[model samples]
Each structure stands twice: as C-alpha cells, then as structure tokens.
Target: MQRLLRRARIPPVRTAPARTAPARTATVRTATVRTRSAAAGTAPLGLLYERHGEPAAVVQLKNLEVPKLGDCDVHVKMLAAPINPADINMIQGTYPLLSPLPAVGGNEGVGEVQEVGRRVAALKPGDWVIPADSGLGTWRTRGVFPEEMLLKVPSDIPVLCAATLSVNPCTAFRVLADFESLAPGDSVIQNAANSGVGQAVIQIARASGIKTINVVRDRPDLPKLVERLMGLGADHVVTEEMLRKPEMKYIFKSTPRPRLALNCVGGKSTTDMLRHLQPKGTMVTYGGMAKQPVMVPVVSHIPQSAFIFRDVRLRGFWMTQWRREHAQDREGVVAMMDALCQLIRGGQLTAPACTEVPLQDYRTALEASMKPFVSSKQILLL
Candidate 1:
C-alpha cells in the first residue's frame, strides 16, 4: 500500500507535493464488465490532497495504483459521488473523521462491483454499492476495498439517489426515528431547510405523514426556494425573519406546534426555531452553519424560563457516532436502507437537486457547492 507505483500503461511519475503512495493492493484482471470511463485502460486517477487546507487548493488529480486483491476484497468501478459540505470539511481537516494526507477526498459515492475476490459473498459483479463507513476515499475512478466497508443497494433507483443516499438521507432517517416519536399530522421544524439533510428530512417526514416548518435565510430568490421546498412536501417555508415575527402564530393555526426542532444552524436561527417548540419539545443540534454560539432566551419575555420554564431538552446528533454505537445492529442498518429504498421505489422520495460534473471538473463543482443560496448538490460523475 505504501509503494510509489503505477500500472504498466501509466505514464512516468512527476514530483508533486500531493503525490502519495498508490492505494490498496490489487492488479486488475481481464474481466467481462468494465466501468464506463474514457480514462480507463490507464492508471486510476483520484483527487488527492497532501495537506489540510482549502480543498480546492491542496487537492490534485493524480494517477493511482491498486494492489493485488485479497480474498475478501471487492473491486469497484466508481460511478457518481456528491460534493458534500462534510467532504469539504474533511479535506480542510476540520471534520472529526479525516483521512491521512495524500488520501482520496470523497466520503460517499456509489460504484459498480466489476469484480469481487473469491471469498466475497454478499456482492457480485454488476452490483451497485456504497461505502458503509467514511474515509474509503470515494472520489476516484476505481479501487479495491475490503468487503465489510461496502453496502449493496438496488440499481433500479436513480444513480444520483444511490450516490447520495449513504449520508444525508440516512442521517435524516436516524434523526426522525431516534428523537421524539412524531406521528402523522405531527410537525417538526428545521433551519437550513434547503440543505441535503433538510431536503431529505422534508421528504421523509412527508412520507411518514408529518408536517415540516422549513426555515432558511432570506435570499434574493426566496420565493423560488420556498416553492421548490413546498413542492417536496414542506408544510410551511419561512425565512428566519418571518419565523421571528409575531405572525408566526398563524402558521400554527392549521397545524400543531412542533415537538421536534432540527437545528443545523446555531445561534439565533436556532433560537428562532426553539421559541416555537412545544413545551418539553426536543431540539437536536447537528451542524453549526451560522458559526455562532446558541443564544437561548431565559428571561421573562417568553412568560417563563427558557430551559426550566418550558423544560425544552437540548441534544446533539452525529451520524458517525450513531453508526459506531450501533455496530452490533447491522440488521437495523440494513432494514433502514431497505425502508428508504422502498420509499424511492414508491416515488415518495427522490434525489436532491443535483448538478453532475465529470470527475476532472471537480474544482468547478467544489466552488459552486461553497457558494451562498446554493440549492443544487454537486455530483462528480466518475
């Protein structure tokens, strides 16, 4: 795995700061099915980063060498992967789960099982799969990986759905299930309402007969965003300012107060949503997009104390940690995936709005993902 080597057809190597030893141990054997890549027949190329900083600056497209396949290894021909905020954070070394330097930069993607080692059982040729854990270095043309790191998914779903499924959707599913037991007609509120997780939450909640109060920052194109989210089953889409206003009471005239508040944006945005929560409601803090400390009002303005008066519960959720604690419940994970796929097949859930870019054009995609008011997810088509 540490060898500075490439396949026989690969061109001579050049000195580069991002250059690292080729990954895994594998020699490609003659196979009946090959991945769709114009750049195939040459060494595999991946987005490699030598240091932690801005992802666009330190990452480079470089040739790779996969080592010989072990009996439990699976050779996957990469397909499509999304450029998620977590991926950017991991590249910058701010994310809790970071790959080693000179490592591939993707954390999630779907790929074809072009070949599986003799001992591989659950997956076979042509099976579409995604990584079960992070740090598999998904932003590459192909790679050989241990079988345990992969999870097979149905191919009938759209490519974008399978590619993006392993992260945001899964997170949404867990958050809804693990938190307050929300029933049909019950409502939940969330900020950053157009994010990948937010979109997933809207759809999943709708499928379960729950209503969602979606909140987003006021942007120039607010109407369009609200329309799109409402089309995806949002019961109400309000700007942060609108949520703060006294007129917010009218939003609850038709539906009940939310017992669950999903706060991805910390600071006042969280407080805005928190104020709307039903007494004893649970607020789950996930991502701090606003980059500010949460300010909860405990003064008599609310007619009672914030924490002691309302008895609102504050908690945090990290998907990686959930997976770790539930390691023994592999069956539970599979069942969740199966339920999500069923939702996809029934047309109850669809892929998030996506812009597919070929692997070589990653820089453009990464830049777009970092911009404000961005709704479409950037997917790299390998």
Candidate 2:
C-alpha cells in the first residue's frame, strides 16, 4: 500500500525579487503567487492522499507523472473543482464507498479534453466534460480517463454550474422527479433549505410551477438567509422554531399541505417536518447533517394513530446508488444534464456563492471548508 508522505509542510514557491523594479511593477509582482502555468508536460502537480485521515493532515501537494492515454481514453485539463462535504468525508474514511490508497482528492469538476485516443469518435480536443461518477479524482491539474467515464457538458454554461452540475443539482432533480407524481401548484416542504440542494430545489421547483416551504435553523443572519432563499423562488422560509409553533397552521391556509417533504437534518427536525406533510405523503431522507438518528417518538409510534394512520412513506436517497442503477442509461443521464444546463443558460438556476483559491493554497481552502456556518462553497482553480 502506498503510504502518505510524512512531510510536515510544503512551502509556497517564491521567485527572487527583480532589481530596479518600477513603481507600477509592485502591484503586478504581488499577484504572481495566484498565477499558474498552463503548459502541459510529463509531470504535473496534484493534491494526493496515501491514506485516510484529516484532509489537512494527509493531503499533500506533489508532482505526479501525467497518466498516459490509452485507446478509447482522453486526457482532461481540469478547469475548476469544488471541495464538497463528501470529499472531506471520503478523506476521513467515513463515506460508504472508499477508494484505494494513494488517491487523488476530488469527486466533481469540469475539464476540457486536451487529447483523445485514435479510437475515440465522440469526443476530441477542447470538448468540455465531467466525470460520469464519483472517484475520478478531479483535484489534479489534468488526468487521462476512459472516454466512457465522462459525460459531455456544454461549455457555454457557467464553469461553476458545470463543475457542480453532476451532484447536488442532479440530486435535487432526482428526488423531485423520481419519488412523486407532482403537478403545477403542488407544494413540497424541506428542511436545510439553505443548502445547495435546497437552493436547487427551490429554483427548479419554481420553474416547474411548484411551490416550496423551506425550513432552516435560526441564526444571527436568519433574516438575510430567508431573504436570499426567497429571492431564489422559495414560497415560504421558516425556522425550526417557527415550524414547531401552532401559528404555522396559518401558512397552510393559502398553500395546500405539502405533498412531499425532503429531510437532510435528522432527529427532531425530521419529526417536525413530518408533522407538516399531507396524509399519505412521502418523506425522503438524503443526509444527516445534524449527526442525529431518525427517531420516531414512542407515543406517536406506528402501533398508535401516527405514521400508519396517515399512510406516510419513508424513503432514503443516495446519489451514488442512483448512478449505479442507471449507469447504462446514457441517454437518461444526458437528458438530465441538458435540462440543468438549459436551466442555467436560461437564467432560471444560479450557482451557489463561492470563494476560489488557487490549487497551491489547498490547505487554506480545506480549513475554510471545515468551518461551521460557512455559506460559501470553496472551489480550487488551476
């Protein structure tokens, strides 16, 4: 097994100061650290991990030989990749699926094809693409991957949206389309409404003429967050405290009871969200951000007049599983991507707020990603 490099730190590269610099040259010199060379070569720099551990501790910047392309393969030049929670969890060895040791560290990103094998017909140099599934190790500056493992993405779409389109937005789309037979004017309620999936849901739902009741935890910036979500087309935004109040009943007078509920934060939040669902409605659980188990109160348990009486259905959704089940359905995946890109190009969907850091400053990006209450997504730029 490959072991992690045990070096304590790798310092940033610096160039020697120029002699007799003009006053105007000072500003240009200060920005040198942020620029990167786009030249291609046998050795390229990448973020790598030889073992599972804290991202800051285990991940290191190293020079790696560019992977050689094989028949039916393409060499991709990474444009931008996001640091996601799942990427962090994979680094911690806590995710359900783990890659072999000495792995590259990102799952989703957008890249341009730099070269294609002679046998490759569908793609060529300069075409934009994204990994067909997770574990393609997208953080590197470039990689050679099998043509089948990538899906073409429109270059016209914003780089951020294209980079992130395969995961969260797709998750939101699947959860809405797969589970329920929804119609215009129908309403859905969901907690963690300030999340990436939540924002996608709000915009997608709005475009389909569906309504959304967004639930979020209260914070010092609660008002601003609510306004932001509303600006994204949420029908209503309520805090967990507001959801528990009897006054919430007034909200239903205008909007019909939610036909579906999406849960990310489990524990009390799940139970409270269930309380607002229409009888015989379905609740889909996608994440457990609160690190609490989904518990059903004994007093309102199924034996009594609770879940069974209401004919409520509980289901779980994992994007990885969905990909596996539909791996061979290439047309389906392309259609979904097309819809999302159209939404983005049409201005109906917007990428989440983001902070970009050059690939060399990954340590700072990793630290920021782990901070609590961080609303901006971190993207590593080449």
C-alpha TM-score for every candidate: 0.89, 0.87
Which parts of model 1 are misplaced by more than 4 Å?
1-41
Q: Which 10-residue window of candidate 2 scores lowest in summed lDDT?
A: 1-10
* TM-score, cand. 2: 0.87
> What lDDT is obtained when candidate 2 is compared to the true structure?
0.80
Q: How well does candidate 1 match the true structure, expressed as C-alpha RMSD?
A: 11.6
Weakest 10 consecutive residues, lDDT, candidate 1?
1-10
Identify the leading candidate in terms of lDDT: 1
For residues 43-151, write the lDDT of model 1, one tens digit per residue.
8778888788997798887777776788999999999999988889888877766665667878889999988999999999999999887778889888988888889
Cα lDDT for residue 317, candidate 2:
83
